[model samples]
Target chain A: MSVLQIFRKTIMAVVCKPIAHFWFGLNLLHKERLPENGPAIIIANHNSHLDTFLLLTLFKTNLLHRLKPVAAADYFLKGGFSSWVSLRLIGILPVTRERKRGESDPLQACYRALERGDILIIFPEGSRGAPEEMSNFKTGIARIARQFPEVPVIPIYLQNAGRALPKGKRVPVPFVFTAIIGEALTYPGDRAEFMEQIRSAMAALKEEAPQLKWPEQES
Target chain B: MSFPFSLPSNTSLTAIVLIYGLLGLASLIYLFQKQRGGGSDELAARLGSWWVIITLMIVPLMLGALPFLLIMSFISFVALKEFLSITPGRMEDRPIVVAAYLTIPLQAFFIWLHAYGIFLILVPVYAFLVLAYLMTTYGKVERFLPSIGIFHWALMTTVYNLGYVSYIMFLPGGCNGTAGNAAIVLFLLIATQLNDVAQYVWGKSFGKRKILPSVSPNKTWEGFIGGWATTALFIAIVGPMMTPMQFPESLLFAALMPLVGFIGDVTMSAIKRDLGVKDTSSLIPGHGGALDRLDSLTFTAPLFFHLLVFTSYGPFAMSCS
Candidate 1:
């Protein structure tokens, strides 16, 4: 493992696990549905920076290196300490959100990362809104899904993470988060249909959040 | 080996055996029900958890005061963490959250030192002023009063109240010749916990009228009366044997402790009702979160300690430190 990988592992083990699981309380469901190997895309609803930490901590320590988050280039890749943390520590596959005029595609980094068999974490909502409140899903994830038809699209509904660490908040208040990982989705039809499918899938996850049965009883 | 506070080793050993024996009886009931093809998974799970809980309580107690202190503080940590996570927080008052987490160990440290003077007032006096001031420093006026109120309240219930349970070790023990300090802790724990069980049993069997319909529908007057009588009787019988109290004082402690535990339970329910979530978190499989389990204890511990101090510790000066 590389030095940065070791540092990331340490953070996941020491800091992130306690803050994300114990302190913030990540009650993960359907975690077994997550593919052990990648060439996979983990799409989630955007809410808080805590979403990234919570998701990153889900993978095994050795597999931590292969887990890469697909974030906005304009925001995350802007040079300095944040860029360093995002690019190196989190290992985000930075994609320029704006339409750029060039022969090269904006999602080139994501495509390259996927081709290399690295699991990409994508937020279809593009940006965060109010806590636990979600907006319309962007088509960027659908395109990624269509391009890599074999790659599994895991829809994770992170409930209450927005309350933990929402946008513009540097310090995170302790709030329990529930990350509901849905079953793996493959590109079913065209881009728009796939987009609609995942969107409704997330909505289904949200509905199931309250009624979902947990085997937490003593018996 | 001698304990920091005098709990006669033999007395505590007997307490351990009795606790284990109770656990064994529970297991046997579970087994019998299984044989009759009427075993519930919930009962099995509850028994499994009780086995662990009983063992955890007894072993640390045998080890000495420090282990018990560690267990109590850990519980406070989990309970506080659950409280903070469940409640909605303002972004501007984020620093105060960190301060809240910091208070757990600091309070525990005071207990380790047996610095009753500082331990008694640290959260009430210092944490109150400092946390409020910390919120003001952020200079965000939106919901300042409510945020401060919530922060201080969280600290009080989770850290301050539970800290009293650990402080019981330092209570000047008048019964040190026969009973150990462990007996006092066990007495409070048993009375409070059994009161909950007794109340649930009574409520299910004969509960007719509701106490606080909107707040906690399950709590009925019958359950309340039955639980009080049962807990008070048990305390009166056991307190004289284990604690430094006569029958009447034991009865008094019994009457108040169970009542206070009920308050704690309902208060937590009110918080849950507002938050729109059930069972703080699933830390314990059978029993909600640590906070859920400790809710009554949080209320009972402080009252139990103060009652002991008022009756036994204050006049005794030094019993067996």
Candidate 2:
């Protein structure tokens, strides 16, 4: 194996796996719904930066090389060690968060990755939001789903991840977070209705989160 | 007469054999129920859980103090993790949480080294001070007082409380005591678990009135009494084989242990009810989380240890006990 391949493999086994499973433990439901091979788009509610790593760790270890997390280009890819780490160590598919009319295609990389049978991980909520609270989702996920009708779109609702490592928090307090996976959906022909369907699915899944109220919530 | 792996005492060997023997009988019953076309999935799941807990406990427990301390430390880590995961804290208090977690290994190490004084006060004194200092710097002044109380309570319940049980294994004569260090631990384990089972069975069979309906609906006065009586009887019979306690001395523990265990169970139930969670997590089959399964220990282990310390062994041993 190449040196870079060995490095990534070691990092995944040693660092990535422990941080996801131990540091911020996941109580995964319907784990079998996560496929081994993919030409799939995995979408989840984004509340923390840790969401990307949590989802990435859920994939089959061997197929991990094929998993690509969709991230914003301007923010993550300033072209340095950060870019290298994001692209190689973390393996992100950079896309433009904002754009002008007829500008360079932000989603071109995602299209190519999907065509290569690589799984694309997207957060419908563009960025991290208030902990344990949901924000209005952008229609980017729907756009991706529309083009790949053959690929199954998986919805995962991660609970307490935001609280585990919320925005601006360096050290995470250990918390048992549940990852509730919803049934896979295929493109529903219309973009607007498809987004609505995904939102409804997320809402239903959120309700499924067992009435988890902490002592602080009570007070 | 001693088996291989240098088991601490013959009593530990007997305990291991008894555990497996019970497991074997349970399997037979499970098989018969399956043949009878009954859905005994919960029974089968419980058997598997018993296997996991037994292995996690017995293997390390028999090896010696170091391994036992290691396992106790691990349990502390998992219990702490389960606790922190459930209780929501401010992002600014992240440093305090990390500091809390870092104490698990140090506390475990102290017990292994028999630094009784330090082990007794590490979490209560040192860790608490460190967390307070961090919280002062990290505090946002929003919910500061309750937050301090949380960090201290979490450490005490998960870390300091269990230290007493682990410390028992390091007693000078513990390794060669009547049954061995493990016998004492095992006695505590079996007694606590039996009390739980006795209460459940009695409640189902004869319980009419609830004890604390809001905190724990299933717990009843009948169950509580039935469980205590059953456990006390078992302790009266088995305590002599495990510890230095005479039958009369064992009776005192029997009465107190079951009562304290009941307290622990309801206390945890209160936490779950407050948190609005059914169980901490489904980590252990047929039980709940590590916290759920060992909740009774949170109260019983320390109380049993202190009783043992003051009456049976240690610097404070009383002539009567």
Candidate 3:
């Protein structure tokens, strides 16, 4: 609601949309895989920054649920203009993913958002990986799902986001892409079994989508 | 029972300009509200400015019917081009199919000449038969027929839909005629757009059951009914003033408008899903693109136009009398 924020959003609504139209190609398929309401976790592989916008477009808002994305705090939550632009203007949530795993909780805020009956989008790979492969998922999403077993954990594949804005690249290259795919994994009560299910579900997501790379094993 | 009257002297033209300016203001306010927290695209702002300017120029020229029709025809041409560009047809058969793009201007011209007789037949019967014949004669039947046929049908709908709306505005009532006609157009535009907004609002507030989980997940039964009910109420209030119909009759028309408009919205949604696009293009701010704008028009225009025909031209008058 700040004046500068107001000014910036108007420009995007008018300016960036046309350019996005010419550059980025967004395809959403089998959107029926995600349920329409309540306590669902959307898990997708991370690739490019533009993945955020593409996901938002795929997450249509009618009257019920509005999709909120969990962005890395270090990158998008730097305060001032950038944070305002990313969080307030673009409707994304910023989480500190760079925090030490045991010492700090990266997904605490995300879990809080979920507990509050909000839709959460988590990039399980933890960081943006090359389009060729998905990295190992952080265990935090599983823990959150375990705590709230009733919630559906939806898996999504974001095709061609890496090409749009790859790691170490500032400029975006337009490659028409699809976002909505993969079925939601219903939670089983056991933790180890659930993690295995998640891993397998994540594998199947990458299997059918041969275009995307499987997650590299942790070093 | 007559609505308050007005003549198109300098005062009325000035009034028209002011009303248009207010509409520009309304669009801005709408953009601000939706995009307040979200970052705005510079492109959307620039295009929106252009849209406002065109709207300003367009409404005043509506002082006369013929000039108004010409201006509208030009808009339809631009709109149709945008539609074709987004929804690509056959690749190899581009040459012969491109001629169909000519139909936009041709239909406009026919409308200008007030040749309703030919205008009605030019697309559906004649154009369809001819386009089908051309595809078969060329013997590229396997590869090109379907795309060519789809392109022809799309063009036909685009022209027919837009022309129907323009035809309504051009009816021979003179400047004062515009006031009454504006009411009809306004009623349709308002009802449809409000339904879209209401569905979004209601869905956000209390949506649960998904209507079409695949095509549009956000569309809930509650939201749809809520939007329809609200739109019906708005239509009932405004309908009689715009048309010669009575209140109950107007209510009936208003009740039907949103259902048609919702269908138009979903039909376009299906197309966007096929094309894998978010918006048709970034033409309209807060709104989306030409197709996004025309989605409602597709249903609203033909339905309301025919409704006008039925009430004014058909046997309804005798029964009412």
Point to the candidate with the largest TM-score.
2
TM-score attained by model 3: 0.52
Which residue runs of candidate 3 sit more than 4 Å off their true CA positions? Answer: A1-219, B1-61, B174-180, B314-321
- Compared with the true structure, model 1 gives a TM-score of 0.79
Instruction: Give each model's clash number.
Output: 5, 2, 33
> For model 2, which pairs clash?
A175-B85, A176-B85
Query: Who is ahead in lDDT, 2 or 3?
Result: 2
Every model's DockQ, to 2 decimals?
A: 0.19, 0.47, 0.02
Ranking by TM-score: 2, 1, 3
Residue B16 shift from truth in candidate 3, angstroms = 6.5
lDDT tens digits, residue span A88-197, model 1 = 88888787778857657788788888999899998888998776688999898877777889888999888666766778777677666677789888998698789888
On residues A136-182, what C-alpha lDDT tens digit does candidate 2 reach at each position?
98987877777889899989998877777788777566777778888
| Residue B154's lDDT in candidate 1 | 89
The sequence of per-residue lDDT tens digits that candidate 2 reaches over residues B16-112 is 8997898889888888888999747777888889988988888888887778888888788888877776665666676777788889888888877
Which runs of model 1 end up more than 4 angstroms from their true locations? Answer: A1-19, A22-24, A27-41, A59-68, A72-120, A127-135, A145-154, A159-175, A180-219, B1-8, B24-45, B55-57, B173-175, B204-211, B220-226, B315-321
Residue-by-residue lDDT tens digits, candidate 1, B149-252 = 88888899999998887877656544444576777788788888898888988999999999999999899999988998898888888887777777778778
Chain B TM, every candidate: 0.92, 0.94, 0.79
lDDT of 3 by residue, A1-219 (tens): 467556645655565555454445434456568667656788888887777666655543330234568777788777899887777667677777556757766667777777877778878787787653677787777777877888888888766566546677776543445454677786687777777777777676654332322234498
- By DockQ rank, best first, the candidates go 2, 1, 3
